[model samples]
Target chain A: MLQQLSAQELPKVEQEMTDFITQYTTQEDLKKSMLYSIEAGGKRIRPLIVLATVQAFQKTLNAPVYQTAGALEMIHTYSLIHDDLPAMDDDDLRRGKPTNHKVFGEALAILAGDGLLTGAFQLISETTLEPTENVLLIQLLAKAAGIGGMVAGQAGDMAAEHQQVSLGELKAIHRGKTGALLTYAFVAGGILAQQPAYVLTLLEKLGGHIGLAFQIRDDLLDVVGTTEALGKQVGQDEKSAKSTYPALLSVAGAKDALEQELAQAQATIEQLTKAAGFQPQVFQELLALFTL
Target chain B: MLQQLSAQELPKVEQEMTDFITQYTTQEDLKKSMLYSIEAGGKRIRPLIVLATVQAFQKTLNAPVYQTAGALEMIHTYSLIHDDLPAMDDDDLRRGKPTNHKVFGEALAILAGDGLLTGAFQLISETTLEPTENVLLIQLLAKAAGIGGMVAGQAGDMAAEHQQVSLGELKAIHRGKTGALLTYAFVAGGILAQQPAYVLTLLEKLGGHIGLAFQIRDDLLDVVGTTEALGKQVGQDEKSAKSTYPALLSVAGAKDALEQELAQAQATIEQLTKAAGFQPQVFQELLALFTL
Candidate 1:
């Protein structure tokens, strides 16, 4: 179910994101630079999760949903662009392509990332959702993607570099870095679907588990997966002397942790089903993607 | 009157911006970096405009108005932070103080700016304004600060460096880079004061003129002002071979242009007073700030 929905809706997410850049940005270089990164490509998993969560609630997959999803992906893409800057992670490639800075130069790449980040809020603001909903969505997105969430997470991650961290501290870092927006995907889906606060709460928990699963899996993949499979250099995290789940938990223990998170996510989906009758099949399939 | 109001309300504006960072960011490093820029002194002209505009309408200077103003300042500050990066203007000083990157390191400086920008939207959403107002404000802000606005302008400005551009093209670049947010400050104030669309339209036009005046004055200042007065490098624009009003127009011609814009701004303010009974004193004093 998740596969079918993702395949069907992912293209629309890409289109919406591209259309946003083309329609709003008139400056030639700015437009081109923005489009370059937006088109550079990723799994669009954040948006896919949003679409799936909305679908699980049996809500109409409206334009607002897609715009919301696209906004999520833009924020994710912008983060990747900035993270790859020479000042930060300094990676030359992302998803096997030249990083944004590598192609656009550092100045324009920084602006492109800034543009995308601000553009995400614009996209959310332009959503066909009710005014109240738009307000909520903007608030949620800013917090999730900004200092309190992803930015802070990145800062923490960098601050902890070349230093061993407690497992709990590591989880906190990933929760802000990756988990915030991933959690937002589900919760925002619930918001758009008009699920009650309690249902949104349950969605938050589910998203949290999923977020943890995602980071652990990413850590595992970096340690054990190949550059070919990952589409970026492998073992870069360990090479940076950065802490990771696999390093802290060991490969086997990290795998156990991943399974636990997946299981918790599955159990939460069941609880959501009981509470709001949200379809669990899509969520279950989503859990499968995180599994090694 | 503008000075009095600015003096009285600017502290509150600073307080709100500071409160926002403190309340939202839990990560100490992120919070410190964000605050470093926010507290780094500037004229706070943008927020002061918002305050004066509300006051001009005989509207209560509400909390929402301050939040909106603070958001504008955040967007402006973020742009400054990013602009001062080694990859951009490579400036080491602003307001006679070390740049954010100089103190915080390049990576943290970048994240801090990102946090402030994203935090701006969060500040807007939390404002007590009507939900519809919040939506419109967010939409306007995202457009002004994002690709279509400041980012695009920055791109155009950088692209045009060492290359001469016509007056019209130069204006377009400055319009996005500085005009957008400066204009936003006025228009958003009108929105908060619940001015009619025509009044808001007039404010937009007024903002346009003020933006032009502001840029012209900046160009003029770079040519003739001292470092003590400017609080940064003087004559850097000419040093970079960047196009400026003084470069295209003679110094006398640039000053002439500045006077023309300030005159147009006064006319628009008068028109607003006629149409909406908004007081003209605040705006007239605002224009005085651009004078040599």
Candidate 2:
């Protein structure tokens, strides 16, 4: 199910992203650095999630949906670019390619990330959505990706490096660092679809659970997955003494947590589907993507 | 005239900025770093420009105007934070205080800048404006602050470091780096006031000339101003081999250029006042702030 959706939607998302990015025709090198990181492919999972959630709501996918999805991807990509900076994670490799700073120097890399981030806001704000909807979407995206969300998580994660942290601390870090934007992706779809308050609430819950499950899976993958499979270095968290779910909870425990979160996510989606009286098969299929 | 406006409006801008920034009630450390940079005051020039432009149109100041002003200041502060990173300008002092990275670690400083940039969008998008207006403001702000505007200029400026750049290249850099946002400030005020196209066009022109004049004056200040007076190290641009206007054009030539730009800016404002049929005494007063 995810494959079919990705095959259909990923190309469109890429096209929209490309079109939006190319609008800045000046600053060839800066544009190149931005395009390089963005064009470097990933699962495009966040955007797919957005499309799926909108589809689940029986809303016809439109420009606003695609642009919002593209914007989220841009934000995600920008964070990754900055995260890979020498002052941060200092990784030289991402997606089996040299990190942004490696290809373009640190200054350009930072600016490229800034460019993408600011561009994301531009894309969303300029979307054809109603003013109230645009406001809601921007508010959600900002809070999720801004200080209260991803940035805070990053700060905490960096601060906790080489230090022992409680399981609670690990959960908080994971929620903000990885969960906020992911959750926003799901909730933003709901916003675009004009989902009712109850439906939106359920979607947020579902997003939270999926976010935890996705992050735990990532921690597990880092521990057990090979560099070839992960497309980046493995065991990085351990090497840097950064706390991870698998580290805080043993591997078996982490797997259990992932299972629990996935189950919770499924339950919430079921509730949402029944309450909203819509088919959520696509959502279910998307959820399955998180499973081992 | 500048003093009277600052005395009345500067405090209000500061208060609004403080109120808006303190809304991030979580991640205490991250919030502190953000507030630290924000509270370490400059002249509040950008926000003041925004406010002054709005007043020039005789619009009763409202929440949206103050919020937009605050947002621009946040963007400016964020850019300074990022520009001062060791990878970029590498300055340790700003406004006679330790740069953000000096006080907060480089990681936190980067995150703080990100927070403020994101927060700026939140402040604007969440404003209680009509949807079309909000969209226009966001588009203008994003374009001015994004890749096509300030970020592009910064990239060009950085790329030109230690290299001999032509006069055309220098103007292009100044336009994006400095002119874009300044122009946006004027245009945004016109937007908020619902000024006609002719007025907005004039404001854009006014902003462009002022932005050029402001930058040239900065270059001159670097060449001649004292550290105690300027609140930053002088001659640092020369020390770093940055291609300033005075470097490419002789000091006298740079001053001549500044005068030309200022005169053009005054003419544009004069035309705007006549066309829009409003007293632009406040705007003329504001322009005086840029003079040596």
Candidate 3:
């Protein structure tokens, strides 16, 4: 269910992003810089989650939902661009492509990230979503992507570098760095579907569990996956002395944590199915994406 | 009148910013970094314009308006923080104090700017205004500050550095770099007052003229003002071969241009006064802010 829905909706999501960037960005150079990152392409997991959550509701998918998904992708992309900047990760490669700064130079790269982040909000505002929905979406996106979420998470991550951190602290970092925006995708989908408040809460918890599972998988991948498969360096956490679930819990223990999160997520899906009319199959399929 | 209103209302704007940041920012270090830039004061001209514009219509000044004003200042502050980055302007001092990057290091500084920019939208979202008003404000802000406006302007400015540019080209750069967000102040004001579409149009024009005037004055100050008064080095534009109003048009020419723009702004104010029941005295005083 998730596969078919993603194949169908992801292209629409990509089109909206492309069209939005082309129509709004005026300068050729800036346009190229922005399009470079947007097109650089990842699995587009955040947008996929958004589309999947919306699809699970069985609502007639529409432009506003696509725009929201695109906006989410933009935020995710901008974070990646900044994350790779010399001042931060200092990474020269993103998904085997030269990082944005490597191609556009640092100034344009920073501006590109700034443009994408700001444009995400613009994209949402331009959506034909009801004003109330638009406002709520913008507010939630800002909160998730802003200091309360990603920024704070990043700060904490940077601070924790070169030092050992406990499991609770590690969870706090992942919650903001990955969880906040990831959770936003589900909550945004629920809002678009106009689900009840309780369903939104359930979706939030489900997103949280999935976020932890996703991070643990990522940490596991870094340790066990080959560099080529990851499309970037593996074991970077060890090189940078960055803390991760596997680092703190050991690889076997980390696998247990991942299973625990997935189990909790499955239970949440059951609740969502009962309360919000969600189809469990789609969520189950989506959950498998987190598993090894 | 502008002075009295600014004196009375500017602190309220400051308080709103402080309160909002304190309430929302979760991490201690992140909060400190965010507040440092906000507290390193400048003229507060943008928020003053917002407040003054709203007051011109005799509308009740409410929390939404203050939130809107506070959001404007946050956007402005974030721009300054990013502008001073080593990747951008590379300034070490802002308002006679160490820049955010200088004090907090580059990674945290970048995140601070990101948080502030995103927080601006969240601040507006939390406002008590009608959802339609909130949506309009967000749309206008994202356009004025995003790739289409300030980001594009900064990109053009960087591209044009150390190169001769036509007056038309220089104006184009300023339109994005400074004019867009400045113009947003007036347009947002008109939106909040529930003015007619035509009134909003007139306010946009008024803002455009004022923006040009402000940029010219800044250029003139760069050429002539003391380091003590400006709180930073002067003549840095010429050192960088930055194409400014003075550089492109000669000092006297730039002064004439400033006067011309101010006259046009006054004319716009007259039209606004007639069309939207705006009081000209408030606008006239606001216009004076652009004069040297």
Mark the regions of model 3 whose C-alpha exceeds 4 Å error after superposition. Answer: none
Residue B152 lDDT, candidate 3, scale 0-100: 90
**Tell me, what's the RMSD of every candidate?**
1.2, 1.7, 1.3
| Docking level of model 3 | high
lDDT of 3 by residue, A1-292 (tens): 7778767888899999999999988677888999999999889889888888887888778999899999999999999999999999998888889999999999899899999999999999999888998999999999999888998899899989899999999999999999999999999999998888999999999999999999999999999899887677788888888899988999999999999999999999988878646777778888999997
Please say which candidate is ahead in lDDT: 2 or 3. 3
The sequence of per-residue lDDT tens digits that candidate 2 reaches over residues B1-292 is 4576578777776777778778763587788899999999987877778878877877777888888888888999999999999999888888889999999888888889999999898888777888778878888888999999999999988878789999999999999998999999998988988998988899899999999999999999999899898767799888888899899899999989988998898888778867564677888888887887
- Interface RMSD of predicted model 1: 0.7
- lDDT per residue for candidate 2 within A1-292, as digits (tens), equals 5676688776888888889889873688899999999999987889999988888877888888999999999999999999999999888988888999999999999999999999999999888788778878888898899877899899888878889999888888878999999999889988888888888898899999999999999989999899897667789888888788888899999999999999999889778866564677888788788887
Candidate 2's C-alpha runs over 4 A off are A275-277, B275-277
lDDT: worst 10-residue window of model 2 chain A: A272-281
Interface RMSD of predicted model 3: 0.8
Error of 3 at B139 (Å): 0.5
What TM-score number comes out for model 3? 0.98
**Candidates 1 and 3: which is better by DockQ?**
1
The TM-score that candidate 1 achieves is 0.98
DockQ of each: 0.90, 0.74, 0.85
Q: Model 2's A-chain: what TM-score?
A: 0.97
| Candidate 3: clashing pairs of residues | none
